[model samples]
Target chain A: MSIDNPETMETPTGEALAEAPILTEVLPELPTVMDEQDLIIETRNLSKRYGRLQAISNLNLQVPRGAIYGFVGPNGAGKTSTMRILTTLMKPSGGEAYINGYSVVTAPREVRRSIGYMPDFFGVYEDMKVWEYLDFFAACYEIPEAQRPGLINDLLELVDLAHRRDDMVDKLSRGMKQRLCLARTLAHDPQVLILDEPASGLDPRARIEIRELLIELAKMGKTIFFSSHILADVNEICTHIGIIEAGQMVAQGPIKAMRQQLMPHRVLVITLLGRLDEAKEALLHVEGILGIVDLPPEDGKIRIKVEFTGEDLRMSEMLQALTSKGIPVVNFAEESSDLEAVFMKATKGIVS
Target chain B: METPATRTRISLNPLRPLLRNPVALKELRGRMRGPRAFVVLTCYLIVVGGFTTLLYIAGTAATYNTTGEVDGGTLGRVLFGSVVAIELFLVTFITPAFTAGSISGEHESQTYDLLRTTLLPERQLVFGKLFSALAYVFLLLLAAIPLQSIAFLFGGVDVEEIVISLLVLLATAIFLGNIGVYYSAMTHRTLRANIMTYVTILAVILVTTAGAVIALAIVEGLDPSTSSSGSEWVLLVARGIFVCLNPLTTLLSTQQYLVNQQTLFTFKYTFTDGTTTTLPSPWIAFTIFYLLLSVVVFFATTRHLKRIEG
Candidate 1:
């Protein structure tokens, strides 16, 4: 059955929360996918097309509980479309997504309850003061009037904007406005957060503050699906990364795993104390060493490429052979591939 | 000890929209806080009050030739006529401006999308705005009550008649507000909505008044006896029917209350076979029928907002 039309076709009958569906029994055989922890959001084959142009195509994403999953993509790569789909703001043309197992199409109200979405750009009613704006959204979220004051303060403190709680939103700096938006999104205490370009247009300090806030929220077990063009920021914080290009996931997995997957062969650059020419000749003669590049005469270092073929003794054997040749190794270490290198190699300059 | 259960809870708030929807309250506050609403209301009060004073002075004037006071019923009719005429003129100017920018203004300011994302249903948004605009109109009308009470100083104006007049005015304001909402929703620009709203009001007034005149003429031309019985009442009834379904006529209905003795027209009709027909109470029946039509219009506006895509 299509999700747009639920099986029973029961029109949303009332304003009260729907009754909880009874869970019969647990199936232990359903193995852990992604992480064994709770899946706050998951999508399979979600596609959104505008006319002939595919904005998002065949997208699959999983956001585990308490993880800050960064969706890194360039503009027009369908980051906003995916966020809109998950937030129940826009319907997908094909496929489906679930928020905490609630179907986005058939059960949008529930999905909305479970997620707080902050768009890239939005207007705040400038006529109202900070407290009134937060109070208004709290009401929209159906927060009880009695408990709202405390929740509002907590959120304000969380976003570090309690001092300007009385100031008009329009008077706030771009960073402060962004922080206020984040606080507003947290008013309902949603389990999952979808922030589109949260760090966009912010100065370095403000971006760092937003980054720290997301990390704190993650520590508190909130599932965060944040999209950004800032790869360095994502690398610093996000445990899982999804790189999108041309409305398709070019590469998506644990950052470490994806890096390992691409660069299985590690390169070692060694600067020697003595016997440099002999060391280069001996490294070339070593069986396990794939390639060797001698540094320029000014640099005085030899770089060797070593491919680990699931063998433990290969590196030791090469080192023993080099030592036997009387080549004293001064500094020898394998170069680690940063996220930027991994991302560049995997995407192959297709983002533009 | 409480047992842990694996389950999911879901519920929908249908009227989550209407109960605490802020649009109506916010719009009311916005309109009332504005300089335009204040200026319009103050002007209406001064005109209504000043006109009533002039009416009182005129009604007390002795005839130029006879040197005697006019009868109470004559004074009543004069006051009613003047009041209705004033209301008609004032409403024509005020109604369009109140509703012209309602929907279109939001679109222009780019606040429509912001409103939609707030989880408030579309119907609530439409009705909230419509009601808020009407509430301001209601306040404006309320401000005119003391001015209207000047008619009661003459002792001929009944309280019931005054109440009925105010009710009619209220109905007209609500009906006109809905017209503004409907057009605002349909059009994208404030300029277009304003032009269309004014054009719509003018078209309805011209068409209905012309139709009433033609219908009255046809009814009168068919019967020789009807000329003596009067055609004003029949024209009023036709106009009321038009106003009930037409927003302009709704505005005109408030004028009916401004008049002291509503002319009840009687028609002695002649069929093609040369038989005569008699009709009574056409004005009352038609006026009431039109009032009902105004309610239906409010419902129609609400329904239109429910399915609005953008």
Candidate 2:
């Protein structure tokens, strides 16, 4: 956890240095006040245009440090464009983007040093072995040659590709390749990771593995800002979610807060074994119940759907009230809110 | 658990990192790893060697009986000239093949974005590609040294001749390599870049030579007298400027200087008032012109890359 030594010169011959422990002294520590900062990646009125077509318009994003900010958008929704600007790979035509307090346009090298970018479609050097590929990138990042061997081994372990260290990159499976790419992004140990559709072409299992790996990276104090069209993957892993559509951000906030804001009412389903009439009468007496719809019985149990306007504690109290009155409540559950539903409510499917 | 072979392969070679160019190292390693590199190298040597042997046989046969003695110096000059000319031609084609795809290949493979996002600057990327391609071309030129050495034994070609020939060849490779890198940065498709690079090289070689020839013909017609005139001097100076930019002219000029101890185009020009002067050697002018032109093209390529990525 020491600062990078500017005086640590690399020998002209690219000789390897003495072996050291993998992670402890290798990577520079995260900035002390990074967590206290309001945003690790921020953009104000960011815009891009290709002649007449606007790729991204008025994009204002604030991604807090140490959070997995999922950028959710449909295809061609300017998600990739926004990520490109933030990664310093492209210029924003109208506005500005800052990474770790450095302007992407004004101080691009600093921005590059602060962020690891994984584009949506990237090519690996098929001729290179996994370890050699990592070593090459580490060299590009100016990591001391002596430090690369241990760093490569550590990254391979992190992405679960330790067994494929010497395997040709082209020989890896799609999932393994995706994981290897993720590992490559971590080679320089940047504080922020900007991944564009990291799981786009992955199978379900591969997607899950990438998701888990991203969660682990976030746990390691890295700010993960990734873009995806897959709402399920985003929902499962992202602590904060931003939904963009048609080159504009529709909504962005914490997942729970977003769900609550988009969906104000909850649907409660109650099942009764024998006291069907008793449960119906008792449910109508609850104060927060707006309406109740009786459903056809299945498996000899009565079902009722109640439109309830209450928080978790009030819902629990209502559940307790039913069981106290000899209603024989077999099951009482509230329907869970999902990202797909939230996305559907948030965007009008417009694209410019 | 390190094997001796692995240890040797991974050993720190100080010269390896001196350039501090990861792109060049990656490219050189990849270029040398495949059997194709060996195949190309072998073919190049065989062709150059086969051609030199044929020239020697022809020259020896032509002059063997007429004088009852073989003139080794004349025979050496013929062999040296032919071999150097062939190397120049081979390099013109070979350099573009190595460089035309350097940048565009990354784009084609979808790796350009990944590379651009790194801390590597655009200049390094451009120069890394140029150096790697030139390095391979230099290797090809190096392989022909033994064939050129045969000229020395024959006694007609001196070390200066061989050195000047290699310098011209190297300069030509560098100039052509810069063209390839330029087009590679301008275009995203490898095929397109390759075609454009070759076209530019052809245009340079053909147009410059043809233009100089036509201009010299007109200038020669202006004054048929053997005596040097002011107008003829002006034309000679103009022709020197034109021919120096062409690699063929530059190579021939260097040979003229080395073999005859004379400039490529020497014309005594008298001013209207009778003061006279001789034009500088085209070889010196060519060397300076090409080196400066290469720098300009390199900066252009670097600027194009920066603009495109932005």
Maximum-DockQ candidate = 2
Q: Can you list the residue pairs that collide in candidate 1?
A: A15-B12, A15-B13, A15-B14, A17-B11, A18-B10, A18-B11, B80-B258, B80-B259, B243-B249
Q: Tell me the TM-score of each prediction against the true structure.
A: 0.75, 0.87
- TM-score of chain B in each prediction: 0.72, 0.88
Q: Identify the leading candidate in terms of TM-score.
A: 2
TM-score of chain B of 2: 0.88
Quote the RMSD, in angstroms, for model 2. Answer: 9.1
Model 2, position A237, has a per-residue lDDT of: 73
Per-residue lDDT of candidate 1, residues A1-352 (tens digit) = 2222121232244321133121111211211224735667788999999889899999988777767788987888899888878877678988889999999888877877788778887666645668767777777777765666778778889999989877877899998888888888887788888898998887555665787788778776688889988777677778788998878888887677878887776666666766766877776666666667655443655444444443546666668778897788867666566777777787756557
lDDT of 1 by residue, B1-310 (tens): 2111111012254533343566664565456654877787788878977897788687767322354645665566467556755775677667767777877787776555445445556667777777666666777777776666665655556676556566656656665666777788778687888888888777877887777567656655654544433454465456445544443344334334334234323345345445666553333444465557656766676676544231
lDDT of 1 at A346: 70
Where in model 1 is the C-alpha error above 4 Å?
A1-37, A267-279, A282-289, A293-335, A348-351, B1-19, B28-119, B154-156, B183-196, B223-240, B246-310
Tell me how far the alpha carbon of residue B201 in candidate 2 is from the true structure, in angstroms, after superposition.
0.9
What's the CA error at residue B225 for candidate 1, in Å?
A: 10
